[model samples]
Target: MTSNMKTQVDDQMVLLSQYYPGIYDQLIPEQGEVVKPRRRRKKNKADGNSSMMRKRKLSDEQVNLLEQNFGNEHKLESERKDRLASELGLDPRQVAVWFQNRRARWKSKKLEEEYSKLKSQHDSTVLEKCQLESEILKLKEQLSEAEKQINSLVERSDGISSTSPCSSFSMEAMEPHFLGGFGMEGLENVFCLPENNYIHGSLDWMNI
Candidate 1:
């Protein structure tokens, strides 16, 4: 059948099911585009005969025992599963399904914890890196200031040398003046020169 014709038929079936809720399953086949089955009243009834097919809630004691087993091993041998089922008064199938669900939840929780730890470590490392970068910038600024101070000192030294009259005087020429308080006579005797000759020689040197 064409697409349009198929849609029309599906619509009609839906209208019929709404009117007659009881015979909807009988009217439709299971082959193409099957409709969802309605909840059966028989299954929902609290009867002992169909209770085995329904989900069974585990008690606190049973849950604690199962968790203890899971702590030991994620997988259980068939014999162990049967033993646990007998002890808990549950079916072997139910015990197996419980283990499967518990293991999945445990694995998910472990992964989430590991992710949080790694993320914290990464944040700490990033913070340390930023602190180090800030320190380096401050050190660079201090070094730049020191360099500027040294340049200023050098410029002042050059200016003083250019302006001072005795800037070109050697250490030998300045030594006598520095020791003059001892007496010019003592200085002349130390150098073996007469006072007048020394004075005239110093004057001629200064003129040159």
Candidate 2:
């Protein structure tokens, strides 16, 4: 082969060697300074392959725009996927996967919000219950105090009623002594008189 042909062949071999490391290395002619084959880049199956095994990824901008335009709560992920697929020039499967992931994320966020609201409600209910319990306890104490006061008053009334008639009799006996001190000696002597005489004397004294 001419020098130009040989050079062209060598260039092709180098290109091939870069693509297939072990296979091309053995077949290619060793010349000036064997070019070490670059380490083959690992092919990302998701990006490079057209197979169904690949997981779909969505751009943040696209996802955010979708959520803004069509609410994250849009039901029917399949329908949303079809619509987004038409807009973004992506496969329906990819859109479907994206929607599935987005829905899961949205659901988790919504559940967290609901949990917070319920927790707040529960806390408020507990506080109200405690306040009500305190009010009930206060009422019970007031009722107990009122009952005690009523009992005390009843006992005092019983004592006073039972002793009042006796007290009035003793007062009548002492009244004559008070009148005698005021030059009512006859009124004092009337108390020592017979019962019938005393009644008549008391009646006369009352009339005067």
Candidate 3:
């Protein structure tokens, strides 16, 4: 077949496949036939091969211009995109895509910063809680020690009271002074006499 005629046939088949998509698959040759599948061009930029569709890196001048504009506003209007594209000698689509990617990166960075701040705050709070708990334990220990000391003092007071000289003096030791044969008169003489007179009188009474 002539190249021109083959091209015409291929074009006709492509048109037919578009009109009837279900029959396109059924029309494949069977057995050992070596048929190359038609290459379909992508209608959308995102559908292209990754290597081919990858965005070109901006030059320093282009980047500086884009960064200046980005500092003012993350989203660019269509007119602004076109103007920037003209000034930087780039396509409007490239400017729009750069802004979209930049905004996404900005949001991610902001989230990361917020997470770090919150984590720091949480750590500080936990440390403060631990310190307070330790302080409470120390206070409890001091209170326990104070109570032990008070108990010890009370026990010592009890021991001192038990061994006091006044506590050891019995009523039996004084009974003779009140119940002697001289009776009430002897008790009055014992109270009124001087030390010397009392000693002489006691000696004389003993002789009697």
Candidate 4:
């Protein structure tokens, strides 16, 4: 310690001795209060303890705000911490720790949002896949029904042609005679007619 520092320490000791008498005298060991040189301890590699001392007293509001900003915005947290530290005349490390906590909080919130969105997408995709599968099943059923109908029609047509002699004749020859048996509805239903008294095939009624 320098003369100026010794003077200051001595002045502090005198003021402090009034509150706790003999405390300063015992610790300081005064013979006119000679300034003692501080001893440096050798570092033990096995010991994890740090020589660095903690600094700065922080308020809840300041700590909370720094932490909160870190979570919401890293850039903003850094800028705010720097600005706040400057304003409060605190070390940058104090502000940095506050922002670190804030960032962790923000990361948790962001992860939650992402998880929710992924879950929503997964649910929607499942629904769409189920719907498409149902539609495919419905289309397959329709195709099966249509095939049965077509097979039935083919059998009926074959029977008609093989059993009916009228299959060889043109319809123009039988038009006048057929016109008498056909009512207004029958005429509407017929497209091609054969020259015979017996009408001998399954009619396709779907168009009518």
Candidate 5:
């Protein structure tokens, strides 16, 4: 061993010697001796895990009764745990552990139910929004078609108006009444042409 390592071991020995009667003054470690304690510790940890996994499971009747009790109350009071243990032919600790595991499963079930409800609501909202957007797009398409026809009729009216000096219709004067947001009905209201003009589709012509 190095001088620093020897000094550390000497200090440890001196400290332990007061409590431990058998202490070695001269120390020498074999090749594998340093690794032995870690191997023993690892083996003991494995044995502890194996023992925990070996716990006995309860019977069907015991599980059903435990489920009924859990449905009635989530918590296991000491008095109730003892009574349940006696009735189910189990230890109180076993009953407590079962209830603890059952409560965890129950909480997960409630969270799943809540998530499903919220997801359904979100889907419904998305569907409604799509429907509204489709209707708005359809209206916009209809309005664009109507505007094209109106422009055609006004151009025809302008030729007839120039020959007859009494006619008051012009594209410039009609523009102030035209609004994009107000659909085809507003277009009909804006165009107050005389009965001598040609009639278009369903545009209820009357004097302004």
Candidate 6:
């Protein structure tokens, strides 16, 4: 490089050093040793191979034996786990994990059964309540019809009395067919009350 260009470069570096003192030492150290950024170590072959390892499928005979042992004891003792692992030619951890998985499946199944039973009972109770409500609504509709009949009877009786001063009410005309359960004697007594007393008195029968 030319002398003038080198002088200009040195002057620019000096100005940068004034503004950032630490950056100048990294770019141009006093002893002239170059600084290299530390590199991260790559993963070992063992770690890479461990991730690629495939799961081994258990033999039919091994599965059957495990099922038999699980049925007898849902939770195995440590010694029993080691004994089964030895017999099956497998690790103790594998035997223990199998039992854990089996227990989890069993617990889930039991919870589902319990939930199904409770849901069935709740549905039945709701249906029974709906049926009872429907019955009550029907009875109310029947009672309304009966009230209209009673009002008609009272009007007919009142008209007859006004027309003939000496005439007595007909026994068959005054008898309410819908209220046959109530004795004719009790019904006749209420109607026998003179004047407008009978109209208000008839309301007593509906109190039941």
State the lDDT of candidate 1 residue by residue for 72-160, as single tens digits.
99998999999999998988998999999998999999999999999999999999999977875664455455545545655676687
Q: How accurate is candidate 1 locally (lDDT)?
A: 0.68
C-alpha lDDT of candidate 6 relative to the true structure: 0.69
Native-referenced Cα lDDT, model 4: 0.59
- Writing each residue's lDDT as its tens digit, candidate 4 over 156-182 gives 776778666534434244344433342
Model 2 ranges off by over 4 Å: 1-57, 76-80, 162-208
Task: Summarize candidate 3's per-residue lDDT along 102-192 as a digit string, tens digits.
Answer: 9999999999999999999999999999997787566445545554554565567667897765455332444445325432322221222
Candidate closest to the true structure, highest TM-score: 5
Candidate 5 vs 6: which has more TM-score: 5
- How big is the positional error of residue 13 in model 5, measured in Å on the Cα after superposition? 18
- Which pairs clash (backbone N, Cα, C closer than 3 Å) in model 3? none
Shift of residue 97 alpha carbon in model 6, Å = 1.0
In model 5, pairs of residues that clash are: none
Q: Which stretches of candidate 4 lie over 4 Å from their true place?
A: 1-58, 67-73, 76-80, 88-90, 162-208
What are the TM-scores, per candidate, against the unseen true structure?
0.50, 0.46, 0.48, 0.44, 0.51, 0.47
Kindly indicate the candidate among 2 and 3 with the higher lDDT.
3
The worst-scoring run of ten residues by lDDT in candidate 2 lies at 199-208
Which of 1 and 6 is ahead in TM-score? 1
Go through the candidates in order and give the clash count of each. Answer: 0, 0, 0, 4, 0, 0
Which candidate do you rate higher for TM-score, 1 or 4? 1
Can you rank all candidates by TM-score, best first? 5, 1, 3, 6, 2, 4
Off by over 4 Å in 5: 1-55, 158-208
lDDT comparison, 1 vs 5, better candidate: 5
Best lDDT among the predictions, by candidate number: 5
What shift in Å separates residue 105 of candidate 4 from its native position after superposition?
2.8
Candidate 1 off by > 4 Å: 1-55, 156-208
